[model samples]
Target chain A: MEKTINLTLKVWRQANATAKGAFESYEVKNISTDSSFLEMLDILNEQLINENKEPVAFDHDCREGICGMCSLYVNGRPHGPDDEVTTCQLHMRKFKDGETITIEPWRSAGFPVIKDLIVNRNAFDSIIAAGGYVSVGTGGVPDGNAMPIPKVDADEAMDAASCIGCGACVAACKNGSAMLFVSAKVSQLALLPQGKVEAARRAKNMVAKMDELGFGNCTNTGACEVECPKGVSIANIARLNREYLKAKCLD
Target chain B: MGTFFSSSIGKKFVMSLSGLFLVIFLLVHLSINALLLVPDGGEMFNNAAHFMALPLIKYGLQPVLFVGFIVHIFYATMLTSINNKARGSVKYAGGNNTKDVMWASKNMYVLGITVAAFMAVHLCDYWVPLQITGNVESTTLHGTEMHDTYALVNAAFSQCWRVALYVVGALGLSLHLTHGFWSAFQTLGASNSLWRKRWTVIGTIFAWVVGVSFSLIAILQHFFYQA
Candidate 1:
């Protein structure tokens, strides 16, 4: 027998932060358990469009769940109840029929609400802009493995580079903190020899840029890790601390 | 300050300094409170309280504690804000992401907010009342009224639910302070990677000892003294 489920969704809809926002309820029915959660949403949107209703707009790109684009808080959990899986990869089977799903965009002063189920995450870019890049251009002046990085450092750098910048850390944070995200970025560069030249400058500039963007402080709560699709370690935060201290002392 | 303040490294340095300061305060507080668990009862506890209440000590250390607490919270807020801002408009494709952090450390902000909320409660229960009333007054086991802070401490930690709440709150505090302690030292220039690793471990142990000692004393007193 084919299993079909019906669910209620109360999604946040706002033209922008300047505009008032409210939860609008919509019913999605006869959903296949095998269908991905986003597919279910696509079904709902299709229904709305057929009825000449404005569809709920959301941000997403690689439905494969590689891009950190699909940012949704389902029933108070970022990326829904599936542990470490983004909404795009979440199959409807994880949910039951007749369930109420509350969907909202990432909420943070830094990531402003852009529209219905969409938020502006440019604050991330600015932080990256602060010092995320190294001074490497088109033509490589050296071989790929020219700089011999230690195994441990290389491993740590790879781990840090795994950060997808999904903004889930911000959403899951009660204070809307971005410590996990920032730490990952810092750890990525701080561990590499190529990242050594401007290490001090990078840490200082990025941190300053983070504060200027209106994000909250890291209270040491681990909610970001729990909700993060990528399990970036809080240890990177410790590494970031060490880097910052060195930078400050040198300065 | 702004030049350093705005820098990522600068913020980490600030966070570490504040964290180290808090850790020192925790050790001192733990030692003092451990007196409450003494079988001699209120004599040792009251005397210690009295020493803390001395004019010079009270006026001087009290102000410093307040400043330390404020600076710790302020820097935490500033650091978190910067991380938030840097995330600006962008998204990622969800994939195989594994976290290296414990559940409690990542939620430090939430735990911190909880701790901060309780700080206000703690201050009101003891500090405000004592300051406003001019002094502590109550009956002791020996029928002496000598600055009986034991009574207030007893009343606060006795209620079943209140004790439970404190235990939970303390757990959060312990978890938070543990991570913050090592992380902070590393920020302030702890030797190299090897030394930093060792210190991180030491920091975690210290945090647990201090946190558990305070919470256990509260619970034990709630059982033994209250009865």
Candidate 2:
């Protein structure tokens, strides 16, 4: 059975980064229940284009959850009402027929809106550029088990590695803190034996860059953990704090 | 050091360190104040208060404690403003509830301001006259002359409104500590799962003990010990 939902979307419309933004209402009719949230936006854009009106501009690359490019503050959450899923994974079934969904950009000093619902997340890229990489030279492909690692450590590292840098943590945080994102990157490298060579430098440099980017301090509110689509834990934040403090003491 | 202190995490580290120091101070303060319950006509209380007033502590530790309080307040105000600005002008218009975060965690600033306001009243009642002016009516205790600090405390707590104020202050401290105790250790690098879980348990108990103990002294003095 094909089910459809008619939603009234109060989408934030901003022409440019410097322009004043406000919520503009549009009615999206006959949206399929199985359509992803982005797909619904696509339908609305198609309607606007057919009517010779300017379409809403949003950022999306792979349309898959892995890309971290699909950024939307659907309703109150970073990725709509769904848990442990990105906006691309959030289907229309989550909404009621007459629901009025509110959408906004990621509101943070580090992430200014480039246009309608499109935020400049280059701050994250800069932070990653700081020290998010291992210092190993490129050569022949190393053996998978060249470095022996405990299963617990490997699993923990993988968990930390799951962060997609979507900026959802900042969006969810009341303080707009990027600790969860920074901590995920820090912990992923800090936990693995291969990345352990420059763990201290990585921790210090990444934290410095994060601070330089004007992100707020973490107060351990744990909102970042709950609203995270990738299920990134604030435990990684604890590890980042540990790593940073250890590095500072040594310095 | 200046650059480090200016950083976001560095600011937080300052807050955590100062908060833990104040927590320790509270424990000592509570124990000293608990002497009010002693039924020896303020003899033991006065003597203990007199020792605390000795020059070594009166000049040395008092200044350090005051600086700790100032630093904590300074950094707290600075961080709160910066964090508020970092959230940007466009506020989240939707509902603001998350399952994992505590209410106290979100409202620590308000709790801190409440506690600070109470401290002003408390200092005016006791610290100013006793520490700064040394005008706290002297009395002899254990064959030595000491400020009748016990009388000051007993007289203050005897008033129902003053007892109510202390209770409110204790409540604010309890809420502040509930998130802060474990959070301080976490910021200081206690990140392991086992230790984090343990700290959460320990932090809650610590908050409860401090709050209940401080409030008990006030309530007890108000109803039972009117001397």
Segments in model 2 whose C-alpha atoms lie over 4 Å from true places: A138-145
The ten-residue window of minimal lDDT in model 2 chain A covers A137-146
Query: Which regions of candidate 1 are displaced past 4 Å?
Result: A137-145, B5-19, B29-227
- lDDT of every predicted structure (CA atoms): 0.76, 0.89
Instruction: Evaluate every candidate with DockQ and list the scores.
Output: 0.20, 0.66
TM-score of 2: 0.96
TM-score of chain B of each: 0.88, 0.96
Count clashing residue pairs per candidate.
Answer: 48, 0
